[model samples]
Target: MHTDARVLNNQSLIEGDICIIGAGAAGISIALDWMNTSKKVILLEGGGFEYDDKVQDLYKGKTTGQKYFPLKASRLHYFGGTTGHWAGMCSPFDEVDFRKREWVPGSGWPISKKDLDPYYAKANETLKLGPYNYEFDYWRKELKDLNPFPLDDKVIRNKMWQYSQAHFGDLYKEAIVEAKNIHLYTYANVVDILAGEGVQHISSVIVKNHEGKTHTVKAKHFILACGAIQNARMLLASNSQAPRGLGNDHDLVGRYFMEHLEIASSELWLFRPFPTNLYSWEYGVTRASAELAITEEIQEKERILNGTASLLPLSVGKHQKPRMETWQDEDPRKSSESLFKNWSEADEAAKSEKGAIERAFQLNTRIEQAPNPNSRVTLMAEKDELGVPRVNLHWELTALDKRSVRRIHQLIGQQFGIAGLGRVKLMDFLRDEDDDTFPDSTNGGWHHMGTTRMSDDPGKGVVNADCRVHGISNLFVAGSACYTTSAAPNPTLTLVALSLRLSDHIKRII
Candidate 1:
């Protein structure tokens, strides 16, 4: 039987077979998986049914590393979590993202891509995505027939398109409302954990509300889907009983923080012009044979399979401009408008400006960042109103990260020229000869990842092979944070797959 906590008043504590934190993509996916199970499931979300600034302020922190858009009231918090602002780009991780590359340090996942393939179909069904096949033939019909994107010229190459465009809240709302065994509680913020002897087991979780009233929930298993940053923060903040924090025995809970370093505001002018009408048809759909296809054939065939990367084609106005800002004016009422209006107010000048070359495609090359311990999210001395310590986001990159970016630039440029897409110019315009001159020139993609990575070794990573905290018997993690490698593809789809996989694992445990 499921109960709506929002309808219930204060001091409401519920017990279940499993308790999931954060009702975003990860949590909802897992909840749906066990909806008909015999076990009682309780899903606790920090925010209420709607978005609010008072709760959103809980995610604010001191920014570091590259410049980033301030944590938006829209970006960080709420009932649905960050999925509210997500541009539903869905692609699976490259096979290389699972392998342990000798060249990249702290690499390799406890489970391979094949290990998770079975769940991808269910993931697609949950996300309202297209068919299951990832082969190029699936997307052949969607091509404009002029010629395949230059990468297609390479005989071993495989390309895929956008498979799923969905909002988690809307997609899963009806099912959740009618779920038989899942209890969803909004406005209940989990603040602490009560652990058993030796801190190896979790007894129950402590949650609070705006009224300062609290409730404690006991469950056989606990999974934190509160996103990459908050997952680490919660574990570190629960340091009262466990001195180094829960599952931090190796001092490795929040280390090795990383985010994709994206180069943007760049343009790719067409060598041969194509029809403008194709934009609507080709924008985003991913089935192996639909409008898009991406496969690992090229990297494997060329023996260049150390790390992962993806090529994305964005439609832009005929004329292209160089400048890209941290934020855009998507919502006028949002803080981004006030902070970024100066640059956006000048959009009229930007559009009418002369000497601009018409662009055919806006290509963004997102590559993997190898884990580096120096790049981390440490706990701050100060605590929140609930006494949970804040997270000090210390995201950093390594020399290998720069190499991957440079190699991607060279490969994309060569492929564009070969495929007659015109010579691709980088947004970060460093000459090929001056590659090693400056490393920090690239900008943050804001696609944050790592920090509490999943690995086979308990000593080196926070979560074990199945995203279970090593010593902690029933605690698990889901989301981009568990990613062993921050691959080039958009992580939304892969994260959902992992979440679904976690649910399957939980079913077996029960």
Candidate 2:
């Protein structure tokens, strides 16, 4: 049953077996997994089914160090979370992504890809993805003309990707509202987590809204399914008892913030027109596509981060501006319009270019940023309408991150020369060998990760292997906040799968 928290009386006490905060992809996926179960699950969403400007203001704050998108526009505040405006690209992390690399300072996860394999298949159902298999051969048999380039398979490999436009708000709204066991609460923004005696366990939480309504939620188990930014902000803001922040005895709650570095790398000028649908996407129509990715062995040998290179037609792509420059409007709606308008103009201008070469394509990179402690989220003194402190972001990138991107493209150029099929011209920013700075055009994938990272030792992380907050027995975080390191692909798929794994663990313990 669906209930708006605004309608609930002040001081209303909501009791449930499991209280899941922030009804985004992770929260909804976990709630759906509990369908028909005897447990009473409470799913809380700060905004209603649609976008609300007031609720969005809570996400607004300041950004420092690296240039970034407007805090308010970076993520959606509605029921669907950022997926409401997401491009819906999906791919699994390589096995090496979960392993410790000597070159990457703070890389490696407590769990491995093997642990998430079953959950990944189960997550595909929730994400509306194709078969669990991401093998190029499997997709080649299923899709038409999915042929790879003539690169050495031993060094470089195709990173297959699937697409899904499943906005949870639009797709699962009715199901969540109709479910008998799940209680869906809208306009319920959790402000502070109230802990009992020793702060070892979360007793209940305090939620408030702009309507001057304050409520309490009591549950046997609490799962914070909010995004990485909000999840850390919430923890840091709830400093009444745990002065250092709950589960933050080591001062590591909001550290190691990571994003996938997405930027224009080089130009791939093929000797001849490469005719294959393998490395292309048709927006909403294409079921699956592939991007050129460096093999695990190559990454280990080269001592670089895992990344993929995607091809965009040089005709239109050459004129395309960086995403950081185009998506500047504070209002997400306006920002999207501006971005689409820019893309449309680029495509339109491409049609009029007489000398546009069909054989050339821009090689854009989607790579993982090296985890740096300085890249973090902190709490600001300014309070939102609900009296919760706003967030302050410091997105610091390291020299390793810069070196990795340049090396990845250099490797690509070397491989292209070996294949004798094309030549790669490095971008202007990468032309200078000693330049250690990224221009304002540097674009990130808008993936927030590692704020509440997981580790078996509390000194190193906020959460444990099972997603439970280290010091708090009944408190858990169920999203990218627990990610130890960011991978090349988008986080939505792995986050959903991780949430499912957490859901199963909660069933056994809670």
Candidate 3:
């Protein structure tokens, strides 16, 4: 039956077959999966329908890594969550993403890529993507000869994969409001999870609002769908009763946070068939000549060969050379003076018809990072609105992550040369502290993961093979936080798939 959560204070506490915290992408996906079911489901959210100062205040913090004004940052803590501003880039994790690599210590997932293939297809459908194929050329032809910008100085090509255009609040509004057995509450912040006798049985969760009022929810099954950071925050904050936090028996609640390190830059080049707005409206990359700089095949081979990374195709802009900049080291292979001279000559070249053919695609690469236990999040002395401790994020990158960056650059340089994409140039003097885009410099990450990792053994993980919290028979996780490995792709698709899988398991239980 439909119920307004605000009635909890005057009336009785709400009880449900399943209770989910946070109404973001994963939470909404789970709610939608059981929309018309007989089992009662309640979805709790911390913020209202739109972005607000109070909601944004929760995300305020001192920057230790990537420094940017909080106002300009795209992340949000509202009803719809961060998906409101998400660029909708959607691509499934490759087979290698689920495997354990020797170079990537503490990597490898309990499940393999094959296990999620079917769910990946379902994720594509939910994201409105046409299909789940990476064959760029065949799809290019299928698009009626829509081509990528042609360039001669660089080997420029386009890569196509699924992209997402989802806004969970808007996408699932009808289902949520109309569902016979579902109740969605706004401005309901989950402050704590109250576990039963053994910390293995999660009996209820405490939620609060701006008015200093509190509400409690009891459920047979509970799922934490809050984003990676907040998910850990809630668990750690609920420590009044549990000494080490609800699922901190192994101290693996918030470790191995990761984000796809993106490098964007721009420069002029001598290439033909230039179009400034290449693939701006396409679902994926559009240029025809571009080859897969990195692929599942490459990643698998790398894993087998003990290599640590895979390459994806890089795209250059068509005209006005997209004005972008990042740091890099001066090529050691060529003296600085020699390269400077060549750059000066190229810079002096006129903008002619042939130069119009010269295209520049803004290229970005997602190099794999090896997991290090040192990079972690722990509880801080500071407390939030509910007199609970805050989370202290301690993120670090291993030397292997740096090595993978260098290796991927080398691989891209070689492939661009071999495929005649262009005169490939590595980033220059980036490690120099003086440079804005130096190696030691930090960047912001939207992909938060590995906080509550999944594993076959409960000793090494918080979630079991099926995503249920190891000791807690009724608690589960369905987001990037459960990932064991950070693949070189967006985490949304995989998250959606896992949420669906979790729904199946929850359905069977409730």
The estimated TM-scores of all candidates read 0.85, 0.99, 0.81
CA lDDT, every prediction?
Answer: 0.67, 0.91, 0.63
User: What does the lDDT read for residue 306 in candidate 2?
Assistant: 90
| lDDT top scorer | 2
Q: Write the per-residue lDDT of candidate 2 for residues 148-251, one digit (tens) a residue.
A: 88889888899999999899889999999999999999999999998999998999999888899999999999999889999999899888999988988999
Range of the 10 consecutive residues with the lowest summed lDDT in candidate 1? 315-324
The predicted structure with the larger lDDT, 2 or 3, is 2
In model 3, state the lDDT of residue 135. Answer: 62
Cα lDDT of model 3 overall? 0.63
RMSD of each: 4.2, 0.9, 8.1
Candidate 1 residue-wise lDDT, 385-499, digit = tens? 7677776776566556555555555566666677676776665544554453334335455566777889778888889878899988999998888888887666777888899
Best by TM-score: 2
